[model samples]
Target: PAPPGEGPSLERFTLAEDELRTVRLRVPEGTSGTELAALCDDLALHDWLLTTVVRMLDGLRLGAGAAQDAGTVVRTLRPAVDHLLHLWMPGARVGRELAALWDPLEERPGFTRQWQVLVQRIRDQLTLHAVPAVHREVDPAPGPPAVLPRE
Candidate 1:
């Protein structure tokens, strides 16, 4: 049941070069406080994760001649990998009805898609950083000799 003239709605906006974002959700009249709180918490966590990752990326010079050192990149992004990456179970605790609230966000901004892309970028950076080390480790030893049997 909607309240008075109010109905379910989700209005989202961004400001400050995507550094600031807001989501206003109007749930049905009978929606429980617990449900609302859970939804808000989930949304807030994701917002923080998105903002933090964006900030981290902005601070990096991935392609510039003065690009960040590999160690610096790892140091900057390690917290996200260790702490935030595993926390993205959106709407997991919300009711089925309320969980549907995430649909619009997913469709328009494609939250999960953006997240996946960002995560991949982080992985690619780390992989690129590791290439030299991997090559060094895999260098053949001086005494490597193998006998080939005739097929």
Candidate 2:
């Protein structure tokens, strides 16, 4: 294979509208089977993650009380937090020949950017829920503190 970026060329296009998203990619002529398979795996992984997160967000009822809503959100998103959050390593396994392919998708659809925003939204929800707990923990003892017999 030619040196990285010298020979291999990648073309990527994405069409995202309403409930449908389509991605098109063209890889250099000499791309190997392993590289092509790896690219497919990478793309499929992102597609699944995107779909899962969108569905999770859609199912959440944002108008519920903070603590209750947070419990629901945590319950809903637990799978993503435990199983999928750490799976965003794009191009980590792709060959040099096809690594450039991700650049176009990143430019057009901003896959990583969207994922980061979604993850942050989850964290913000959890943090917002936690604030009440923290406040309760810090509140002074109710009524009056019993006078301590001389320490």
Candidate 3:
């Protein structure tokens, strides 16, 4: 097997859409397979969530023409609400050694912040197209209309 590449990638996450998702990590030399697998799963989840958010954002661009075809914009964003909203757990499973990797990312250009903004935008867009149910006011019955007699 070839030598492991350069620095501690912390972890490397690769997603090929429908084809594959690969998470490669560098742990201490003697770490057990179970530990490695756990790390990979953790990294993969983060990658998938991040990737999903970017994809969701890509569908949201309501400009001048939005007023005409508003429903389509809302429809485009619903999948992110249904599928990607709950997947954010930053470094939840990462060990102390590599937890630092999440810091720079969580700062300045924050992933979680972007995810929140995207979700909110999706919700707001949908709201823009939603029609509220009309409530009609009716007067109280007046003693069954004085017991109408058959003509």
The parts of candidate 3 lying over 4 Å away from their true place are 1-29, 131-151
Order the candidate numbers by TM-score, best to worst: 1, 2, 3
Top-lDDT structure, candidate number: 1
Better of 2 and 3 by TM-score: 2
Residue by residue across 33-101, what tens digits does model 3's lDDT show? 665566567756766676776676566667556443555665676677777777778777866655665
Quality of model 3 by C-alpha lDDT: 0.62
Candidate 1's C-alpha runs over 4 A off are: 1-7, 13-20, 143-145, 148-151
RMSD values for the candidates in order, in angstroms, are 3.2, 4.5, 8.8
Output the lDDT of residue 35, model 1: 78
Task: Report the C-alpha lDDT of model 2 over 17-106, residue by residue, as the tens digit.
Answer: 764545455554567888888977888788778778878877876645433555676788788889988999988889887788788668
lDDT tens digits by residue: candidate 1, 1-151: 4466665666653546646556677778788888778877887787777778878877888965765788998898888899888887777877776787788778878778888888999899889888877887897868869879999
Q: Report the poorest 10 consecutive residues by lDDT, candidate 1.
A: 12-21
Any runs in candidate 2 off by more than 4 Å, and if so which?
1-6, 9-23, 63-68, 137-139, 142-151
